[model samples]
Target chain A: MIKQLFRSCIFLLVLNAALSSCSNNGVVKESSTADKMGRFPEKGDMIMLTDRPPQLETPLNIFQQDITPNDYFFVRWHLSQILTKIDIDTFRLYIGGAVDKPIAISMKDLKSKYPADSVIALAICSGNSRSTFSPRVPSGQWGNGAMGNAKWKGVKLKTILEAAGIKKGAIEVTFQGMDKGPLPDIPVFVKSLSIDHALDGEVLIAYEMNGQDIPMLNGYPLKLVVPGWYATYWVGSLNTIKVLTDTFKGFWMTKAYQVVNNAEANESPDSPAKVTVPVSHIKLNSIFILPEPHQPVAYGQPCHVEGLAFNDGTGIKKVEVSVDSGKNWMETTLNPEISKYSWRRWKYEWVPKTIGINHLMVRATDNNGFTQTSKQWNRGGYAKGFIEQLDVKVK
Target chain B: MLKKTQFIFIATLCCLFLVLHSCTQQKQPDIAKPADENPNTFTVKGSVREIFINHDEPDFPEAEGKEIFTSTCTMCHTLRYISIQPNFPHKTWEAEVNKMITKFHAPIDSVRAGKIVNYLVTIKGVKQ
Candidate 1:
């Protein structure tokens, strides 16, 4: 009996080591302890802003791929209590309020009942490059990694609402996710869309992202995909949809995510814009993918510069790159459009003449003939579509 | 003799499983709480797995109002939010504090809000 027990102890130790190593496999932690807050499960090494309600930013290099992988997608949540676990068997998306009939649809029903639809869209945060804003901003302090393009597949919100029989008086529809706040007074993260926009057939209740189930941090089970609009309206872990007759004056719509009601969404710090509206369609913007910040380019050699240009699916008319600040602009070759809502990749071939630091900039012009402004500022640091410049050293 | 041997084999299997499972469990931090609060089992029911984040608190410089800053601000988010921010003017930091209280409805009294702003400006402040 003693000999058998000793053998069991040895077996247990070996088993423990194997299981522990397996769990730690592929766990990549950033070298700088100060920059890396924590590594969440089901995600690669992300720039973790906050842990409680994770605000993770994807590394910039991950944008090289047109379709952002589910594992490397950026995550942003407002409330502290985010849903960590979900049961698809019991989960029900309740549609109620100004509808003729309230219906509770299960995950299985949602996938099987509705005609499945998919759209390649770019879901970007309104304050994506908030850290790069001049004079700086207090929130998130995110680099250009808070956006991702993915093929979202699921049912359309219009199909669900129509089946539920929308009442005539319904003017607006409110969406609420499973996330909640620590305090009852702290308003839940609720966003509203006009009844017309909700039924546009473009808005989707996404179940699969990039051909697979979305990572939990990126909103598993269900996520609202509002193409061409800022991601603030993309409610994650979505469970409730309510139609209302009156305009929804939720805090998220009115108090937060509001930008100046101007062409450029610009406002002076000294004289902040009095008139503000909820941020809607994304603005024209482009970002460099190659020769990362401070990454050197070969002098007297043809260097290939690549980047992504995206806007509110307005269709990119052209993308231009300037090697010497904004003195001269060369039109970049845009790759074939994947979809109207997806970001278009652009590339430029440049031969560096100077051997020292050179300023490289990129700007995008949309189908509406709107070019990105060189300098744009807003107090909220929202809707950052200003021209982006990267200083590359030539050796 | 056959029954005793069978019992020992089953007991050994149980022991090995328990030891392996315990080794794979994620280590929880003192400040951060996993969504599944059950200490006995970190596993959640259904297809989705429970997410665990190892939140190591950021170090803050010793200054006045550090206590009030850490206590009041950390109620909603971690200190990395502040750590990631570039130095802003006192006015900017003050506005941020007020925005948190007024806009987000963070339960911070005026006195506490002032101290928190002072602490942020003291460490992460700039003359702008």
Candidate 2:
């Protein structure tokens, strides 16, 4: 009996040490934490960049479908103290500041009192592909998964503000959410838009996403969906709307998320641009979906190459693919547009002739005749609108 | 009597195996279940259930001032923020640490802040 007990103790210790080493060895990869897959509540396994102010990126394969599911939607929040629990019954969206008759509307009131509006729009992070930028910037080093397309259901911002009776001198509209900073001096996360953009019927205060209540992590009760703009403006767990007569200069707007005042928002590292403006409007970009990086393709087999092309609500005129290192270009068939603001899917049938590695590139042209440029760089790594290239090996 | 002792020993070994497996699986930080729910699982509330993210800190390389770096930086965010960043110049790391102190009001003293910057520069700094 004594001999048996000693043997069992030795066996258990060995097992424990082996398992601990396995987990420790897994962290040997560069950026192991970023590469580590995590499953948050109500979310699928995603690339977790941080956990405190949860920043989760959707897997790239989820974008193959036209509509990104709410469970796999990308999440990005700025403030550290996020809303974990809430009493939806007592929640009220307060509308005041530069209004003749300020009013507080409940969730029930928001749905019943105002007309319901729905739109299928794409909300992309301003720094979505910041990792891919050459001379990499030191922000959220995300790939092309920091964006998602969803069917947002809510009342129009115009309708909500008009119901509040906007004063005559209202110049800009500011939005605030329940999220707060850790320190009192740390500025509360807020964003502003011009009065004209706020009153635009397209801007929505979404309560439901993809046919259900927005996930708590994605912003439970309310989310401001600024269609055609970067997701930075789409505040989550939104509670307050203020109409300011003067220009609203907040830390988020005037200081952070500012890009160069140019078409591509490009700048040099040695000499940064002096003038900068708040980042808005998704830039023209396209990404290859099929034949994922390093995926093998059979020689002489007609592979169905697929991708997505999108701009700032401007309809895509065409998406061209180059299989021969941009020496030749072929136009791909664009699927029917879901909405003016939704991403347009494009497909191409290509037969690989070469047996070695073949470089594939994709670029999009919008209705305004603006074709994606081959090179772009910025200090903040915002607005990755350059041409995308993917390489695949043919067996 | 010998058979009974053997049976008890086997039972204890099985329980040890189970406990060891669970210990390896629990790499993520412990999070409490929602109110009035099972300890092991989350309550399914329609399609959009509440979510709790995993806060597993990465194993950073050991160096001088690593303790200060980990404690000061993680006061607001996970060390993954630093793990995900590509190698930057010393000036960039200095600016980043100073920004935390000045802009975001991180309560790191100047001397410790310099030490933290030195640690970051040692691990992930590149020449401009």
Candidate 3:
């Protein structure tokens, strides 16, 4: 009986050792703290994000302010070698060609001669909603943060040209920024403006933004702030100001930013024509910021949904939110109107009554009765306006 | 019978001690050598040493550049705005840099401009 008990005890000890080893092998390593806190994509990941086509992914929050901060501003560089620093002195802005007397003015002279003006304007990429297109276009898949509002202070373009003395035969005035990149034909960064539009009082040569000097990213020292126009025309590090004799044919002005309409309508290779014009006026559009995409919420809990809305020329009249897939809509409360050009913030409280998938859609109506709708397909992928939608799952 | 049981117990304890002692004495297999020897060394030539060293210091001079960037650039804008652009070549960069001084009036001269460019080139410039 004693011998049998000893053998049984040995067998039990071996079995316990084997079980412990198996458990050790099956152990799952605890996730690191860094994994828990999702940091910005490391250097290797930026390329992946840039190359991958834009999807319905939420933008990574980089700033503490309700408004997206400037550093964390989404980058959209068409060409390479964007500028960093500039010397303000000895820098000359030439206003010639269509002007009676071509005037070259120094920075000091510009400040002293012209009256400084400030206006808060929203600078948005013309292709802000490009990714929503059916066939994804090839460009920076910018999220909503591609736009921002700042108080721009500068001399109005009309004031600058009036002093220069405009001449006839000057149908357009060309504005060239110091930003230079190599093109297939011309190795320079330049754009032109129509004479009538160039002389508009709203067009300005901005030196200050948000009560401070403009940052390098936003065109430090000086940048052109064409109120209500897309940022593509707001040339940065402006170096040349020429009064054009005729229509400007710069690469960006003519070839690149143009929208080619009727591509399928006309099957010919050259059937489509260049849009070649700066996007004017903000379209009525809204975005959903809170309860990010695919975020889960407790059943029957009130979720606050918020977003921003703005228009280029007209003021935003109302922003409406729909939870039942646009069948019914409710007007959201608008934050205090900051500036005519800056986007107005809006929010709505939503309580999910049922435990299921809910589709949320937001649409904005401008003062002029223009509402956001699906964009017509074009080659240049300009002015895409699909209704922004979000899907949320509730437990 | 008791004497025989005590002897058996002593023998069993001795056997267990010998087995444990032998197991402890057995040498663990030497750790497998790393697959590749030169792990950190770059395959290409021409000093990666400079890049490592250059990146070590905060590209912007902590005191001077910050002061100049804030006082001048921030007068009209924020420093966060300027740092966004990737670096550029000297020529194209010169034009934009001059715009601030000539068009915007940043109070920078040729000497100061050179310093600012040097600082910016280190931080923002893309490697050719």
Global lDDT scores for all candidate models: 0.86, 0.88, 0.59
Which ten-residue region of model 3 chain B has the weakest summed lDDT?
B49-58
User: Model 1, range B76-120, lDDT digits (tens) per residue?
Assistant: 777777877889899889988998888778899989988998999
Clashing pairs in 2: A41-B51
Q: What's the true lDDT of residue B95 in model 3?
A: 58
Specify the poorest-scoring 10-residue window by lDDT in model 2 chain A.
A26-35
* Candidate 1 lDDT tens digits, A1-395: 76876687677778777876765543433334334634566676677777767898989899889999887889999888888777778899999999999999998999999999999999999999998888676788888999999999999999999999999999999999999997778889999999999999999999999888877888877999999999999999999999999999999999888889998888887798888999999988999998777788889999989999999988999999999989999999999998999999999989999999999999999999999989888988998989999999999
Which has the higher lDDT value, candidate number 1 or candidate number 3? 1
| Tens-place lDDT digits, model 3, residues A155-236 | 9989989898888787887777665443233335666778888877889998776666555545655688887777778887
Top candidate when judged by lDDT against the true structure: 2
TM-score of each: 0.85, 0.88, 0.62
Root-mean-square deviation (CA) per prediction: 9.2, 5.1, 16.8
Say which candidate scores most in TM-score: 2
Pairwise DockQ winner, candidates 2 and 3: 2
TM-score ranking, high to low: 2, 1, 3
lDDT of 2 at A231: 96
The weakest ten consecutive residues by lDDT in model 3 chain A span: A43-52
Q: Write the per-residue lDDT of candidate 3 for residues B12-110, one digit (tens) a residue.
A: 755765565445334333221122321212121331110010000112436445555445543433243333244455543565567557644456788
